[model samples]
Structures are given as structure tokens and as C-alpha cells.
Target: MTTFTVPPVLEARAPAEARGVARDGVRLMVSRGTAVSHHRFTDLPGLLDPGDLLVVNNSATLPAAIETIDGVRVHVSTEQPDGTWLVEPRDFDAARPGLRLRVPSGSLTLLRPFTSRLWVAAADVPGGRVEYLTRHGRPIRYSYTDRDWPISTYQNAYATVPGSAEMPSAGRPLTGAVLSALAGRGVLVAPLTLHTGVASAEVDEPPYPEWFRVPSSTASLIGHVRRSGGRVIAVGTTVVRALETGTPEGWTDVVIGPDHPIRYVDGLLTGLHEPRASHLKMLTAVAGEEALRASYESALRERYLWHEFGDVHLLLR
Candidate 1:
């Protein structure tokens, strides 16, 4: 694996304002090997040939942000099969072992506190399930935004099935018009589900876990794309994890990196990740370390924004 140098400038995070929408809306950076290019997201259709396949994670973002009466904020991270929630709360005082949370219509009784942030709560949804509680009263918004944006704003125009706690972000730039344009150009689009858990903070916290699946149809379609000499362009890192994790043999705990060989995706369209984010490791798995570093440096010099709701980078082999 080639080791590319990370630019010092790229080490510092960009201001939130710089990460907001561009005039044309989507900001795009394209990379091929070590060379880099730039364009607006609207120029996507022109970037690919007719036969390229775009694979998107259709997992929808849920309204997982909630606020407690005491102003303690919690973000629901994951939902258990039994319906209990894995949560991360902020400014939690140990005194409150349990709390009553108000939702859209009803209230939830938090049973036990798992950690300083995590808790087990029960709620009455359409089905009887222990709902994971978070401080989010609405959808998880980016730090840059002041008010809570509607959950719809956090979703890609093609998003289906509400499951993810947050948007798969890399796919955010693909609006409805772009999807239609891609379809019109004969680029086949496919979907998979990978419910994202939580954003990876720049700390020692465990890597957020997620549940994902690639159906037989999606697997076959991916095989067909490869057989037809069409590039499989993953829309986001979430899609990358879904496709990579759901290889036919079975699911894997594989943390992607340079040592791992990509079995499915031929190209990647993703947002600029933070320094040391595990997603960057996944990119290295696909593009090699040297190329990945070069692309990141280019992105920094070119002022590509980082984090969700930031700029996007497309790497094509």
C-alpha cells in the first residue's frame, strides 16, 4: 500500500460556514489516481459513461435527536432487535437514573442508564418496542446549522425506508434531478440498506456499529456490472460498508484499510472525512494509501469542505 502524505492544512477542520452549500449547491472534486479535478455536483452526469453503475445506500435517516426536560441532549445511536435503544446523551447528571421523555405524541419511560450517555428506554410506537432515546427532538442536524432542519432536508432525494440515524451524506448531493439524469443516460442505479449508527467523533469512543444488508438482487446486479465492464460507483462510505460487509460468503467485521482488497466497488463518491476517521481507512482500502493521501491533500488545497453536509469527492480508478 502506498503511503501518501497528508497536507498540514488538511489536518485543521474547515469552518462550518465553508462546509455549507455552494452556489450551484453540490461541490464536487474528482480524483483519478494521483491527479485531481473539480466540478459542480450538477456536472455528475457528464462525469460518467453510460454504462457505469451507481450503488446507493437507501437507508433513511430517523428522527433520533431528543431533548430531555432538564435540557440534557441525547442522540439515539442504534436500535436493538428487542426494541431497546443504544443512546448517547450529553450533560447527563448521574442523579437521574430514570427520566420521562416526551416524543411526537407520547412519553417514553427511560428504565436504566447504561453509561454516562447510553440508556435503555421503553416506548409505545405502532409496535411495542423499547425505543432508543436520544437528546434529539428531531433529526440529527450538522453542527453548522442553527435550527433543526427537517428530516427530509437530511435525506437524499432517492432515500427510501426510514432507518439510519443520520444521512449517508456522500449520497446527499444526488438530488432527484440528478437521479433522473443518470437514469436517462443509461447508468443503472441500485440500492442497499445500511442503517448508520452515529458519527465517529475524534476520540477514543468505540466505532459506531451499524446493521446492513445487500439483497440477492443487488449482489447479482453488482456481479452483472462487473461482468459487463461497468464500474460500480458506491455513493457513500455507508454503501461501501454495506457492499463490502455483505459479500456473498457472509457478513464481516472487516474494518477497511490498505490491507483489505475491495471485492465490489470500482469507484467511490463520498464526502471529505475528518482526520483519522475510519472511513478514510476504507478509502485507502479502495484507492491505496498513497492515492488516498494525494486526493485528501488536493481536497484540502482546493478547499473541499469536510464532514456531513460538506463537499464531495469522487475517486475513479
Candidate 2:
């Protein structure tokens, strides 16, 4: 995949709302073939046709980052089929098997390395997983964020099924007003559930298997939309991953890129990705190299914000 260095200035250090901008007030960059245009996220309703189906991931954000007694931050990624959890000890490199980290009312013992960056751990929390996280965990924060924000700050207004390790932030700009506007404009909206695991920022790794469910209703709606000659506009790459999996529900590790075939989606609405990020490959599959390159160049030149709390990109056929 082609890549470029992301200037530090373009990184969004705080949520738009904290920066005195409404969540839906972020910039929107549109890429169609080789042409690029810009608009505010609120103008999304006016940008699409009536018959288009906007598919959104309804997976909610998990307050997955918990601090140990020694101040080590642990990111709970997902629950494995064997009932153990996948976790990453942020900035703590000396971790090994049998290492136990104590939290507020729970303890996590690393069983083994799940990957180079994550570990398979046994979580012993008194209450349930959801209850414990609600009481003790905060949303995972990266270095780019200026300070700690509440879990609410990391959530999408439409999110309901809580499971994602991090916020599926491309949908963050989709506020109630935008939904109502899209509905009023006769644009269709559907939902799928994909519990995203920990995002790999340090490695050029392919996506890990994450549990996903495409409801029968959503599957049928997608078929109807396509047969009616309407477009399936995935609100985020997570949505594309779920839809293209072509299954009702299960763990999906499918990696999309230039060589990968895109069978279900026609367009995408997402955030600006980092250079060399695996997501760029999926974007290339949707927008093609020429348009994708053009869009990124325009985004950098226009100073569109990057990251979960940043600007958005819309790629259309």
C-alpha cells in the first residue's frame, strides 16, 4: 500500500465539542472518482441521494482501560471463546506469562502473549464484566488526546450494544439531528453489530478477528436496497467488514485492500486514517488508488483533523 507521513499538527488532540465545536460540526471531505470536495459533517444529508442505504455499526464503546496499582494501564480488547480476555499493557514492555496486575476490585493475570502487543488474561472482577468496567474503567486514551474525557465523550449518540474496545468513531459525527435529517430526506439507515477489538497503532498488522452480527433484518434490507438500484453506504469500515463477510454472525478476520474483492458496499463514510494503517487498504478497495491518494492529499492540504475525534471522509462510486 502507498503511504505518507502524517504531520503532528493535523492530529486532533481533543474532541470537537471540547474545542468549541459541535460533534457534527467537524469537516467532511468527499471523494468521488478523482474529484474531491469538502463540507461540514452536518451537510451530510444534502450530499447523498434518497434511495441510498446508510449502514451503521451499533456497537457501543467499552470503558475498557483500567489502571493497575502501579499505574500501568491495561486495555481490555475482547473476550475469547475460551472465556479469557485479550488485553494490552500500554507502555509496559516487561510483561510475561503469570504477571498479575491488580485493579480497583479486580485482578488480571496474563496467561500468555496473544500477539506481540496483546496478552490473553484471566479477569477476576467481583461484579460482572459490564458492572466492573462501569465502576472502574475509563475509555482508552492514546497520547494524542490532551486529557482524560468521560466514557460518554467517547460514545456515538446512536450506539446501543456495548462491546467495542474503542469507539467506532466514524459514526461519532452522526448526531440525532443528522439522523433526523437523513430520515426526512428519504435516505435509509440500517444497523449491524461488530464488537471491535483493540486497534493496533504500533504495528502494520492485519485486523484481528472480531465478533460481528448481521441481523436478518439488516441482511434483507441490504438485498432490497441493492435490487432497487440504491447504494449501500457503510457509515464506517467496521460496517463494511461486517457486510462483506457475507455471514449472519461470527468472528471475522477478513482483511480488505486492493487485492480483496468488495461485494456488498458501494460507498463509505469514515475518518482519516494514519499513514501505513491497514484501513488505508480497505479505503483503496472502495475509492481506488487514484481517488484515495487525491483525497488524502487534499485532506492534508486543507488541514482536516485526524483520529476518532476528528474530521470525516466520504468515498462514493
Best candidate, TM-score-wise? 2
> Which regions of candidate 2 deviate over 4 angstroms?
none
Cand. 2 Cα-lDDT: 0.91
Clashes of each: 11, 0
In order of appearance, the predictions have TM-scores of: 0.81, 0.97
Query: Tens digits of per-residue lDDT for model 1 on 1-317?
Result: 33344443443233233446542365788888888888888889889988899999887777777766556666776776676766666566553446666554455567777554566666644433213322234786555454656666677777776777777878877877888888888899998887777675323233455677787887898888899999999998878777777564333345666777888889999887766567777788878777887887777677766666567899987
TM-score of 1: 0.81
With candidate 2 superimposed using the best TM-score fit, by how many Å does residue 284's alpha carbon deviate from the native?
0.7
